[model samples]
Target: MRILSAPLLPLLVTFIPPHVTRAQTTSVVLPFRRTFSLSVSASPIILSLPAQNEPYWLSVALCGAILPYPRFFVSNESDVTLPGPGGVQGSQTGEELNLDEGLITYRAQMSSGGALAIWPSSGAGANWTIDVAAIQDDFPTHRRLSQLPLLGDTSATRALIFSPPFFTRETQEPIFPNYTFQDAIPSVPPIPSSAEPNTTLLLFPTANANATVWLTNSACALTSKLGGVMTTTATRTVYRDSSGWRRQWFVDGLSASTNYTAYVIENNAQVSGPSYLRTKSDSFPCPLAHSIPYCPEVSYAVPLPAPPGSATSYTDDNIPQDIKA
Candidate 1:
């Protein structure tokens, strides 16, 4: 089965501070305010089932935190009633949502099968609210607290993190051939003239094969002579195990408007080809503070076409006996 997910919300507000104050002296006082707010919004929880229908459940990771524990409520806008811990109704009565450690997930079952899910409206605002009086004791004695600043409403910022509704892993069928014997190397993109010192190189490998990938200005020269002039400032490596495929390199503090290249070797053997990439230049005026540096535009290599005559090897098994003879 194929599962696709996308980030439901782009921005997520985590903490909400209430207003508080402390008097330092007869004439002096300090005021404390909430820097951020916590909001939760999710796409309708969905569960798609096969022909043989069976009861299924929807599970989502909950993200938010509060100093004093706050009650959480899950409203089932649908006609069905959701079962909760201790057989409680869909909504829990008090401030039960506490975001201390990291991420928390919640699960709810559907009475009927066939792709059950929830559709929370975008910018619907915070689904849950907290009681300021209940958490007053946990407030800092020295520091003051106040209502969180409102850049936007709570619902406007809360977003789904892990399982976005727009993610898809369907691999595109290769229009070209595969390099069975040849080494598949890494390639980098060009750097713009206005780049930052902390540039990120995104490397996308074809197969989930256990290979050694590196960033070097030297190796790239083998394919393109211009790559040789570039220098290798950093290196990173990733191993493809049973879990999944991923890029292992993240280079920071790089020079601006500089040319760079990346190399990929399968099992220590240098691949026949390498990729060339460059960093953007830093000619534009800096944003915020003049001394603060900005990031540059990054470029990445496109997937190369497979070598010719490789089709026979892959389709050899499907060929007819008469045709093969």
Candidate 2:
């Protein structure tokens, strides 16, 4: 299924099977994740964007908190009954639709009383809305907004964290001759850059001859695959001196604490030795306590307490666990 437009009125989502394709589309799948308790008073529109074609926001996580189970359909639009005005008027709901090379991105909308909160999938989005008792179906979307500054509704509050967004491939690219027998090593810190700091930057790095998978792993075990794809060129790094391939593939859509299987399917024909990977937990900009695959450097932020000109002192209880570890 796929969604095309996100205007305030009649949000048009096409319920197409995964086997079909669409020529007119700009949809991207968002990595399944959570939204921490942050508030933003904007239009009632949620988008699922693939990392490769991410918009200017370039965000990694998202969440939602709705009430009365807004409304969704895989077949009949008229069958949907929303609390307020605004639904498929000119046409019937649940129109059979086909999709594209992109995995899927059907559509959804909110009622006047619905809330929007986001948090990581590891925890609830403040409270999970998608996992409510009223609804019991596994659709394409997850419930994860944790903080809605002034939300007043209460129905689905059990939050749900999610994995990263990705696109299902119709066929795999042919493996390069030089790409064979090489390992795809994942790297980030010990030696870091501004965009890829030792602990903060969420970008994952991996390289193997002409192919690179930023998802992390060991020197010989072949760690794993991270992120769907990046349109930009690969960057070279000398972080390891001369131990492995100098070229690096920085994957943008890496998922935290998730397992991925890596393999090469040349021209969708011959398959080679596949590698499995599991990414770290903590992520950039998320200061929550103890996210999986965590780094000891990150933590929930605390304001500096001592005087401006004084040397600061922090007790063991006040220190972040990761830093203390």
TM-score list, all predictions: 0.21, 0.17
Tens-place lDDT per residue, model 2, 234-281, is: 222323222221222223244455544433221111122233444445
lDDT of 2 at 208: 44
lDDT of 2 at 41: 22
lDDT of 1: 0.24
Candidate 1 Cα outliers beyond 4 Å, as residue runs: 1-57, 60-62, 73-102, 112-244, 253-325
lDDT of 1 by residue, 153-172 (tens): 00111100010011122333
Candidate 2 overall lDDT versus native = 0.25
